[model samples]
Target: MVRPRLTIYVCQESQHGRDPQHEHEDGDSSTGTFFVYHAVYLEELTAAELTEKLAQLFRVPAQQIQQIYKQGPTGIHVLVSDEMIQNFQDESCFVLDTMKAESNDSYHIILK
Candidate 1:
């Protein structure tokens, strides 16, 4: 199967609440356009666990993932764009008060 490329563009202009699909029409080409793929929603991931998971996901060494995690949110931003947070929220639900909190989120990401 073929997958559609995930293209991301960051514009210098102040714009918000715009749909990703209509980004081109909303801004000038001179801003900045980036090409990124594999943005994962972060949930039920502690810094330690996230490091291991990221290493596996990116097929890189665990030390590299640790370095990124140590850099804090900025490093994570380098690995994944913040847009995935909104994408996750829009596409998922977290029963925080439930007994099986992680199960649902994990299931949503892995299976459903």
Candidate 2:
């Protein structure tokens, strides 16, 4: 069976001391500094595991990840925690839909 693939656009900016909530409140658009990644997986992953994968891909520390957001029809949806990712998968069928549609929709990973 072919593994499911996800395309993510990870923001290169470090959150550091910035407020994660307010990062996008001012309506700032994408900086075009993202490191695009195509992640293929056969099994569902926890947020920490996802973070570890991203850290390896980006060569950054996992702890530097402050949050992860998925772009949705309504708005950006947060998936920074295990519970949140699980709830998102359950409610929105994110992984299934991505697998079916082969959508290249970006998942934003905010670094600290």
Candidate 3:
């Protein structure tokens, strides 16, 4: 049987808060560094599970993720929820906003 798969682009929020006006002016609404993720699902996945996967990918605690947004037209960010994931599509892009104010370069590395 074929398994479900998705190709997603994940971006870390910039240290500076997003400015819609500036993004529009610059004409590059999606300007941040994005990491491509190819996810394959053998079974159904939940929002919490997805969060954990993202946490692992970014090397940060899952709790640090404050919000997850689906990038819309012109860089509009739409809040992602369980309901949203129910209808999630392949090749969608998302931006991760963490609780900390530091840049993504400052992500802690925990040695296990």
Candidate 4:
């Protein structure tokens, strides 16, 4: 089956941990509408492990998160909704907390 492409436009204020959804009227998922959270970042964690962690943290089934980057010791992005993103940012939950990790290997979650 065909699916919609979700290329996130990382908001500049993503690191601030604030309310940041700017959906457009067209109801587009990736463009001028909808604050769908796609890529999530977690510091000091490998993409593979981070993916697993996200599934557990969100109580999701499995294989929900996917590794987008091949290199660089950065955070992992967990696929989620705009609402979930808000929660993550507000609570600095599993994904947002990664940005504060002391290890450089850690990752910071981002929407893709």
Q: Give each prediction's root-mean-square deviation over alpha carbons.
A: 14.8, 13.6, 9.8, 14.3
* Model 2 C-alpha lDDT per residue in residues 1-112, reported as the tens digit of each score: 6554333333333224444454554223344221222443413547766667766766666666555656556654544666644543321222211111133333345322
Instruction: Estimate TM-scores for all models.
Output: 0.30, 0.40, 0.47, 0.24
Ranking by lDDT: 3, 2, 4, 1
Return the TM-score for candidate 3, rounded to 2 decimals: 0.47
Candidate 2 or 4, higher TM-score?
A: 2
Better of 1 and 2 by TM-score: 2
Measured with C-alpha atoms, the lDDT of residue 25 in candidate 1 is 55
Q: Locate the minimum summed-lDDT window of 10 residues in model 1.
A: 92-101
> lDDT at 54 for candidate 1?
47
Model 4 scores a C-alpha lDDT of 0.37
| Comparing 2 and 3 on lDDT, the stronger one | 3
Q: What's the number of clashes in each of the models?
A: 0, 0, 0, 17
For model 3, the stretches where C-alpha displacement exceeds 4 angstroms are 1-43, 91-112
- In model 2, how many backbone clashes occur? 0
Residue 88 miss distance in model 1 (angstroms): 11
Residue-by-residue lDDT tens digits, candidate 3, 73-92: 66666766667666767655
lDDT string, candidate 1, 1-112, tens digits: 5442322121123435545665665354454442222333345434444345545654655654322311233322222233433233333322111112243322111111
lDDT of 4 at 74: 62
User: What is the Cα-based lDDT of residue 25 in candidate 4?
Assistant: 39
